[model samples]
Target: GGIPQVIARSYLAWWLGSPAWSPDGSRIAYGVYLEGSPDGDTVQIWTVNPDGTHPRLLVNLGECRAACAEGLAWSPDGSMLAFHSIRGVPAGTRAIYTVRADGSGLRRINRDGLQPSWSPDGSRLAFVRFPTPGGIPGEITHGELLTMASDGSDAIPVLEDVALSPNGLAWNPVG
Candidate 1:
């Protein structure tokens, strides 16, 4: 009886990246890229109850021309989610965005950042920043480990002089 159950099923699109759980574990949030759409392809965020009910669209991040929205992280208090969107512009420019769980207050936080993980206290977020911008799509390149305030300010480099391209992030749970 230890097997997990499927909570939801998608019809026309495939999930784009990792899904994140709310701080209290009451819900799950994930992104999906629409497929076979006459309008066009776009990545959108959605959240659903664990029982596969009440699936709702949170935000529509348009036109993932080269890269898709990946890496979803919920704020410790469950107020917002921070994730990166790789837009069609600049070829490979990745940017971070945060949106309220209820689909309000969506804003782009940083450019050239990915894999945003929240600090244990939710006061800051750490992400990977690419150096010199513009790189080959879907290829790992040199980057730096950097952190910034939850409001997307006060960015500081935590490590440098090393070839790094982080694919995921998590804070020490104990805090």
Candidate 2:
């Protein structure tokens, strides 16, 4: 093989997002796009091993109008994963959700947040939130730095006017 050797494959027809590795480095998780059966184009979360084994479904977010299961981050303890999805919400809206690695306890934590990053202690999640409204397809909107508990409660905006469009987020390891 080449320098970048091939790894695992999801075996799904289409994959729509990046793959995230568990904190313990045991598994990789990603989102698969299911298109045009009875459900139209939907994105679902899936997991696989580093060596391309034991692929399985993690979170089944039915019918993400735009995108789903993006910016996945494993909790420090490797218990859950936080990601953004357009599932179960109005079109053009993205939300943060967490699901257990074992494919249980799927819950939406925030309504309009994306690219969730877990705090060092795994007690809270920091994500980018689109606070201001109205924009064209490529136009930039105001994004805020927000944090919430692991269970998706008590959301507080930490910083206002972070950037016009924030893609990913991370917490300071020493902070």
Candidate 3:
């Protein structure tokens, strides 16, 4: 389609989320949800080449269905993708994740995170991690912005109170 829109849930409808294009603008990583029923949604990772060819499903959430997943963004070098997943909180509990560009070597790189923004230099990525405490899930405990190396090292808290409500996270790259 010229402009994609929500194809509403049916038995096999796939509701696609925002599309994240690669740094070189050669491809896109996006979210897709296969409706289990009219009321059930299963989130997963999907990708399509820039030319809209070779569209493929990268990761299935069935293995991690207890978690909700979305918000896919690519690294500056187009070598990897950074996205978020939630561990079942109705609205969701998020964490950041990464995977190789070819769709191999998937990894859950962080806990309690969202909105992964990779630095232009490809050295680090910034994300928002929520503050969940006392095993209580209803409180709006506030989320803080964070940055970490691509290899999952040297995680640093950079900004706070920057996350938007409802979606719950955001971060901008440092120039």
- The C-alpha lDDT values of all candidates are 0.80, 0.76, 0.67
Backbone clashes for every candidate come to 0, 0, 0
TM-score of each: 0.88, 0.85, 0.72
Model 1 worst lDDT run, 10 consecutive residues: 132-141
Model 3 TM-score is 0.72
Off by over 4 Å in 2: 8-14, 37-40, 134-140
Q: Give me the displacement of residue 54 in model 2, in angstroms.
A: 1.3
lDDT of 3 by residue, 39-71 (tens): 466667777777677778787665345335566
- How good is model 2 by TM-score? 0.85
Please provide, for model 2 over 49-145, each residue's C-alpha lDDT reduced to its tens digit, 9 standing for 90 to 100. 8787777878677765556777889999999988887556356677788888888999888888878899999999987777666322234676778
- Candidate 1 off by > 4 Å: 132-140
lDDT string for model 1 (1-175, tens) is 6778887666777555468889898889988888766658777889988777888989988767644667899999999999887775666668889999999998998977888999989899998877765333345677678899998899999886556656766677874
- Of candidate 3, the 10-residue stretch with the lowest lDDT total is 132-141
Q: Which wins on TM-score, candidate 1 or candidate 3?
A: 1
Where model 3 places Cα greater than 4 Å from the true spot, the runs are 1-11, 37-41, 63-67, 88-91, 132-141, 161-174
Q: What is the alpha-carbon lDDT of model 1 when measured against the actual structure? A: 0.80
Whole-structure CA lDDT of model 3: 0.67
